[model samples]
Target: MSGYCGASALNRFVNDLLFFRNRLPLHVAEFSSYGGDNFDEAVQYLELWIRYSLSCPVAKLSVTSHDKYQRWLLPKGLITSEHLTALQLTRVKTQDDLDFSSCVSLKHLKMTDCGIYCDRIMSPSLKRLMIAQCHFIGYARTQIYASNLILLLLVDCMGMTPLLVSMPYLVEAFIRLGYCNDFCKHSYEIGDCGDESCWGCQFYEDNYGNNNCILLHGLSSCTNLELTAATAPFIFRKDLTRCPVFSKLKTLLLNEWCITNNLGALICFLQHSPVLEKLIIQFEPPEIHERLVEIGGSYDLRKQSLVLKDLNVEVRCDDGDERVHKVLDVLGSYGLSPEKFKIQRPPKLTRARFDDTWTSGSFSFEQEI
Candidate 1:
């Protein structure tokens, strides 16, 4: 139902749904509501509808609120559903401490453009979890516990990157941290930032002790993984010291952040992934005075062991040849032969074209080291 409908109409719709009490085992249920003249009443009706639908034992449920000014709290019943297998929430505000352990049968869960005010998300049966364009509003970092998760996509998420608990079955994951994330607010290079007052640095030091693995250890089992961030985030760089050996990883994709600090992070991954086959690097235009800022300690690439079958590098700037040469020089030092890699450059570069390169895989091979 559209938010344009008045409260009376909404109440009528709920009444109609209540009238059809025989409709048990609902295959799918979707509800949308934006701010209306009677906002509070609309919310009440929406909650009522949600509660009634849960009683029908919905297999799949999707709730979306288009009102940007306010976010509707998810009904408690939705969180504790036994029949819900798939759930998608958009523009909704979760409670202060959101937990989904009660969703025993839920397999797929996706949240987009939502406010996450919780400190942890715990689920046992979830196989696929995707959170995109969401804001995590809590002061402490959110921990994700989805032991059975096989696929995870966390794209453009803001506010302290969530810590991933071990998911031994995870096969694929794509994490792209946005510019508004907490780590991006700091100016100094991650890990090396000596500012005593910087919370970002302190948070990393305190949270990432010898035993704590912020991301890499949990993601070690994934066969295919993509790690991208706007303005180099600290989690990836900090986790490098304790980065678990990606024994199962075959394909890996990294962005400019990996090479920010003299290609140390890039080389570290190569050294760790013994059986890695294909590696793709997406290089953005370099700033005029953007010198390589050292974040992680340098690795001796001469001791590298992993031999990649194919390495694709796509440069998004016109003066990419020089940069590409520099990159090859570094890799060459690490014993990666010229024939193992290919370079691609589009005639006209745009963000859309750059993003499409991942799926298209159509390279001219005009520039090969």
Candidate 2:
């Protein structure tokens, strides 16, 4: 297919498959660009097909472009559609103050590398939301009012102001607040939002900083939370007005950066989460934390009192002395025996059928409920 006919052909294909005989029925629409001359025009025609096929409301819609520079602004007509159950967009730019009030069936929304200028996302039926490497623009804060959301994942997203989320139903979350290296440099190059002062800015004062108190407040209802090194610093501050009670948190995962440098914050979670059951300590490679000081974050270890239940801890095998003892001693004080802790190292084969030369001893920790 060539220029003008290629776009027309796409419309014809949709007409035959979805909007045939003027019948409007709910269906899935997936539009991916084919790296052609009319990539933008293809997207526009596809939107037209969606508008004309309103009677057949789309249940799931995924739209993407082949070129990163060519971004599609999500049409308002689709946002207000009553039958959209799942929507996924990549390499798109969203209009400011876009209203999704009419999205009655939207349950899952995912955006990757998109520019989001909207001030608020007020969806009542949205259940899961994921934003990765997306830019949140032009606001001091973006208010997310998804009262029904269950899972929220934000990974390496830049240019986001503080977030105020009303996710009463959130059960799990994964947050990595900043870029792994040179966040400001990369984020500013694309979004035009950062400046020379970015380098001198304090961790708590910057985009991915301590200003996330409200973000943490919104996630207080979650039962399982995972924090990367970037996001863990938000909880490391000793000046936190009051630690938000994680009344339902049961499982927590913190990376090597959090465990090695912020033992105080680790103790903070141990004190606040009354019923935490599983704590997984993920390890970074050997070169990451050699220059880092030991447990310098200002938190009161005196405030730590164990109210945990059957807590199982798994550690990554590293040749570090301080961070290792720091975790073990804390758990040991929580009444967990050394037998309950397992060090995860490289793969070692265990042969029960032919193990005549190697011998191992078994130990266990028994905690009565």
Candidate 3:
């Protein structure tokens, strides 16, 4: 029942359910706050249901707090359940005493707007983890060790310290990390002090030396990778010391933000991936492109022969410029047919942009008239 229950009635219900919960064949139990007057009563009943589910053979447990004012603190004992395979929590907050290492059977974990205070999450059986709009609680860096993980998605998460991951079987990953207000000081230091004729921003230089080394190592096995504009700067700002090999990667999607700003990272990917087939780069906002031109590249990826086949480049420019042609020439040097590399200018002057698709087949290179 997803309706309101009085305090006394809820207590009685839990007492009654306790007698037969062991005998009932419970596979899934979902609880959502529909409507209720007594808040404590509702919380007690929800806690009781969670406890019951943890004690049985329940495979899935989902709890949602649709009301903005309603936030639930996840019970610490919830992770101790040996049978839970899937857990979905919305608007949930975790405390320091929580331990997720005991969730050995957990395969899928989805958290939205959650505050994670734990320092480490070690799950051997976890396969998919999706976290969106969530924030870390303390100053500790988040460490995750999942050997069998296949898919990982992190979107718009904030307050993230250095992240360390060790996943050997990861196949598909999408990481979109946007600028948060908390890192404003670091941004100002880099933007104001490090200008034209400056060596570089010390703040970003320190972050590069720490963040990407381990994170990129974890993502080396992905077959399809998408890095939005937000996470592009991490690679753009640094000259990688040790690059990971993307042996299985076939498809890669990059925002024009990365190409315009951190072309070296793109070059690094090309050098590492031995069998990359498709590359799609989307046009970013004008402001972002301008910033890249200002302080983007002082260093570039080392030249190496690559096995890339298909290239799709999207650009926002007034007309075909020398800079754009230079990029095409670079790719051509890598063995892509310049004839098949045709740029399609928009019919009307709507935006400063064009799309070019290059397929590695025997075709004539057509030039713009």
Best by TM-score: 1
Tens digits of lDDT, candidate 2, 260-362: 3346556766777788888777665556543223332255557657754478887765665346677788668768887778777523324211111211111
How far does residue 163 in candidate 3 sit from its true spot (Å)? Answer: 1.5
Give a tens-digit lDDT track for model 1, residues 17-115: 677766566788888764566556657667767777778878888888757478788754356788889888888887656667777899988888898
What C-alpha lDDT, on a 0 to 100 scale, does residue 219 get in candidate 3?
Answer: 78
> Considering every candidate listed, which one attains the maximal lDDT?
1
Q: What local distance difference test score does each model get? A: 0.70, 0.61, 0.59
Candidate 1 local distance difference test against the native = 0.70
TM-score of 1: 0.84
- lDDT by residue for model 3 over 108-132, one digit each (tens)? 8888887776766567888887777
Show the colliding residue pairs in model 1.
Answer: none
| Off by more than 4 A, model 3 | 1-22, 34-42, 97-99, 180-214, 235-242, 285-297, 303-329, 339-369
TM-score computed on alpha carbons, candidate 2: 0.74
Residue 230 CA error for candidate 3 (Å)?
3.7
Relative to the true structure, candidate 3 reaches a TM of: 0.72
Kindly indicate the candidate among 1 and 2 with the higher TM-score: 1
In model 2, the runs with Cα more than 4 Å from the true position are 1-21, 37-39, 180-212, 230-242, 260-262, 288-297, 307-309, 318-322, 346-369
Rank the models by TM-score, top first.
Answer: 1, 2, 3
Give the CA lDDT, 0 to 100, for residue 66 in model 3.
47
